[model samples]
Target: MKSKKEKGIKYFLKKLGPGNHYPKAILYLMLVFSIPATVLNIGSDIAGMGAVSNLLIPAIPSFVFSIVFTTVLTITIIKFSYQQIAGILKWLCLSVLLYIIVPFFIKVNWMDVLKHTFIPTIKFDQDYIEILVALLGTTISPYLFFWQATMEAEDVKHKIKAVVVDKQMLRDVKTDVNTGMFASNLVMFFIILTTGIVLHGNIKDISTVDQAAKALEPVVGKLSYVCFAIGVLGTGFLAIPILAGSLSYIIAETFDWKQGLDKHFGEAKGFYITIVISLAIGLVINLTGINPMKTLVYTSILYGVTAPVMIAVILHVCNNKKVMKGHTNSLLSNILGFITLIVMTVSAVMLIYFSLHH
Candidate 1:
């Protein structure tokens, strides 16, 4: 299912009906929330590191402006290939290992961890549900779905020769995706464990950067702050580009405008402009004096609220014989997909109910 250019989820949604605009609009809404969320995340990381180091970071507006300017300059002017970007991300990903190491350094209740791992506790209160939804939203983000689909399409299109879709290729794709998901979740698990164990009683709310960095201090001492700061900065740098690129791909594909990272600014003006605009909007959001950490939480909650609909659409497309041909979802895939759909739907409903009633 390779084409000459990247055709994202929007393209697949188009195949369902030429005139269907709702799905496209829903996607646009998701990106609208995602861009500012990503910008806020990056800004928070920069601010966090500065505070941890006791370096006088520029004021929030100037700091945010500098980040936007640097990002725009790097993406637009330098023109780094996807391979180079991936290489940098590989190093950044190692920063997650810091989280993994933290649990080993601190005392942990292994029995409790194992028990909770198998049987998670349930809570219906608004605060608990909100955090639960945010966790779900961040972990299974909608943008990742777009990013993976577009990048895979781009990869096939850029190949010199037509790539064959064989069993080996399918297996490779499965392995790649599985490995990535496993690693990501593992890092997240350790991060939660470290924070919950070390900072649970001491810090009631992690509203500031210093509070966040303190989770690592029990193990790494002063270097713990530095380590935490570096990890945040690294992951922020890695994620911001992909987040912007994913939004750009969605817009370009929906409107049938020219799009590709490999293309020059002059060649794909609309695509590049979309990226620039999204980043600019994110910058504007940071200037409004909203708390970055709170913004991140809200962003994740927004992702959670919209996720079930997106998942339903994906399940529809995957099961449709016309779209997948012989590559339709297997029984296991369908079962898991439905379970996710039901869980997310229930969570979102309860969240709404609790927010209004509580």
Candidate 2:
């Protein structure tokens, strides 16, 4: 009988075999086209540490260290089994919870927070519209869609059984996804709320990750700066792998090369190489003198422009009878998904208009 590692290798090999070639090809094309955005996003996260370096470390060296640290940690994580990586990712998810607690420590107008959260406040000014585009892009990112699907497939493949999904399994998947999204958005909401209350008018501009962290000091003491920095670092550690690994997986699958986190370097040279190149590129982005915050926002703009197309493709593919095999999306899913597509489309259009006019 084959060992567990052998079975895992065989499973990924099967995924690379003839089937789902079209989707694989699309993912590969999208990955290549979005490399700049992905690398910039990663660089921005790495640069986030520089925001708090005055209290934590020296700015220049801290920024450089962040890049090296992220690259090394990402490579080490990639060398683990998917199961191990998943477990680590779960813990890293908790790091963002600091944002949730921040709002309570700051003075906030609950009424205004409620109004903004529930009611759509229309603002057509250049900066306001640009922020809207950036928010939407950062939230519904392309890398996330690919990572979840591929990771699910990896989990199933690890089971080494027929692709027969049960009702309970489907329900569990939906629940997990919904819960995760809710937590993520809730964190984002609170971060915005606290920042708006404490730092919005007080700080005219936030250019670096350290500058952003500094804003938390007057509102919630110096320790809040530490929490904010830790959150950024934790999320970056979790995110870089997904950014690079998603692209690597797509490339490996597209070319029918060996893939999966469980495989050895010799066994999956191409897969690992793609990941290394991606991280290397991201590290180089940090070395450049580009303002990390602006680069991050611009990366989000890139994602905003591309998101509508990806959403449309996902909607079509997920709803196809042949593809879904009688398990197509429900009415609720269609409604939510299409609404997302429309919002992203509108955001992208408005962003371009404002950029031209402003």
Q: What lDDT does each candidate get? A: 0.70, 0.76
Task: Give candidate 1 misplaced runs (Cα > 4 Å).
Answer: 1-69, 72-78
In model 2, what lDDT does residue 303 have?
Answer: 84
lDDT of 1 by residue, 1-358 (tens): 6354335333543454322524567666655655555555544443433344442233444454446544754464227666666667677788778778877876788999999989998987999999999999988887788888776665555542423445665676778788998999999998788877877777778876566776557677877667876676666666767777877887787777878776787878998888777666665555555565677788789788877877887888787776566888999999999999999989999999998997
**Model 2, residue 101: displacement in angstroms?**
0.7
lDDT of 2 by residue, 3-114 (tens): 7765655655464432453556676567665666777887776666544453476545765576667667666856787788889888988888877888887567888778
- TM-score to true structure, per model: 0.85, 0.90
Predicted model with the maximum TM-score = 2
- Give the runs in model 2 whose Cα sits over 4 Å from its true position: 1-29, 50-55, 160-163
